[model samples]
Target: MTTATPQTATIGHLLRDTDLSRPAYEQLLADATLLKHQRASGTIVPRLLGLNIAVIFEKPSTRTRSAFEVALHDEGAGCTYMDSASSHLGSSESFEDTAKVLSRFYDGIAYRGFGQNSVNELANHASIPVWNALTNEWHPTQALADMLTMMETTTKPLQDVIVCFLGDGHDNVANSLMTSAAILGMDVRIAAPAPLQPDPAVVAAAQDIAAQSGARVTVTTDVDEAIARADFLYTDVWVSMGESEESWDHRVPLLTPYRVDAAMMSRTGNPKTQFLHCLPSIHDSTTALGKKIFNRYGLNGAEVSNEVFHSTASRVYDQAENRMHTIKAVMLSSLASMTQGDR
Candidate 1:
């Protein structure tokens, strides 16, 4: 068996999936797995001792913020949380200024916000390593966690696995998934409406990665064809952050056809097909948004059904938990690279 051995020395900033090579990506997963085991066995060695990290967010978060804080803490690094109201990044002060200021106090900076250019600007201006938590273009951390979850669950090698994503393929989650899957040599397919298809540049980039890795990257309008033999069915909210509430009238109708219900799961033709979602999911008419969606569309769910979301095959929470482990791995590897004069 070929084990992962990432060239940590070469990795500088993790702004996107293209930042690391195939070996590095696999090695990161291997690192995350080892860290997870160490954590479970209560033998986790903190490599980042005495280091301070900043978690800056222009948007609200439940998993990313918690995961970063807990993961950094577990690794013996101090964490500082800066929410939208507290951190005047690009509002009262420029993002470049904030980046320079934060770089002074924090050894590393994690940013989750609206624009890709914003994060890019901070990375360009800051001397320290900058991690892209999320932007309209990509959610690299979530993709890492999702890959970890799939790595743990899949019976075969990573290259043999197939993951099909349904819903608005234009979103960050789908874009990240495509790039990561391509890098890891997993067969990935995205099914969505023509207008909601992934960015052409992202697709082209993933295609380039796929060529070397032997990963098949497919984007299509045919939902059945996309999930035909998929080992995992993945999706995210039809409407995402930075999108207007009024977009529901347009997106809901366009995307409802791609909803992952029991019929859709059955169509995969893989009985063991696992369900994956980057929550908070609209599986039932419980939450206010769920209730509103139900009232407006008369649908129980938007992207995924309650039956699949609550079923034994649902690995969404597992995906959620892996965020901390993989995130810790990212911080450790990035910081280690910096300390060893690799960057």
Candidate 2:
């Protein structure tokens, strides 16, 4: 991994996974792993010593929000968090104006929101690095954490690994997984009902990346076919945030068959196959949504089962933990070289 010098201080924002080349992706992973170990050993380095960053989230999050806040604090930086209710991004003032104003106060920005265009507009306005924490289109930061978890759990090289995503294949998590896996040279499979499969353009884009990286990218409706000997079984919420609750009426029946239950895991034909969910999962009737799902559909889970989510094969929690490490790497690589005078 080549280190960035002061001359190359302003690394571009991570608006999407394709923003990173193969070498850059690998470098970030290596940096993340080192940072994780350093954090564990109490030798964590603080790169953003005097920097101040802001996280503006238009969507609600548990992992991403906590990860960004903790990661910045660990790196000796000050951070301010603005939730959707607190920040009037488009309603009160334009996203462009908000971006320009915030850029002056913060060194970098992390935004999780509904439209890709919002993040794009913000990035266009700000001179500093802007990361897309989430959008309707992509979740690159989550994908980074997920891949780091995969590397920790598997012995095979990335090129030889197979990962299958089940349910809501069109969602942000699926898109990012396809994009990141292709860049990392992993065999990627998407299994969902026909209506919920990933966008053709997204598949085509991942395929183009795969062609250069020797990765295989496939989308299938047959759950058994997609999961065959898969090294990882991944999922996201069948319906995402900002989507109407009414969407569940249609999505539930269509996605139930693809749910990551023990049976679906067994279909993988790999007993060692680990389960991954970009959670807030409907694993049990613990949350209000989970309870409603069970009561309405007579289904205990939406995209994953309780048995699997809490099982030994689940690495979802580890995946969540890695988000901090990888995000720290992104910020450090992007802003660490800039000094007070440079700013």
TM-score of each: 0.96, 0.96
User: Candidate 1, which segments miss by more than 4 Å at Cα?
Assistant: 1-10, 337-343
Estimate, for each residue in 158-198, the C-alpha lDDT of model 2 and write its tens digit.
Answer: 88999999899999999999999999999999998999999
State candidate 1's TM-score.
Answer: 0.96
Q: What's the lDDT for residue 37 in model 2? A: 83
Candidate 2, poorest ten consecutive residues by summed lDDT: 1-10
Residue-by-residue lDDT tens digits, candidate 1, 1-343: 2111244533557887778788788878988898888888888766677789988999889999989999988878898999888877777999889888888898899999998898899899898888999998989999999999999998889899999999999999999999999998999999999999999989999999999999999999999899998999999998897788899999988898899988999999999999999998989999999999999989987889999999998999999999999888888777875545553
Clash pairs of candidate 2? none
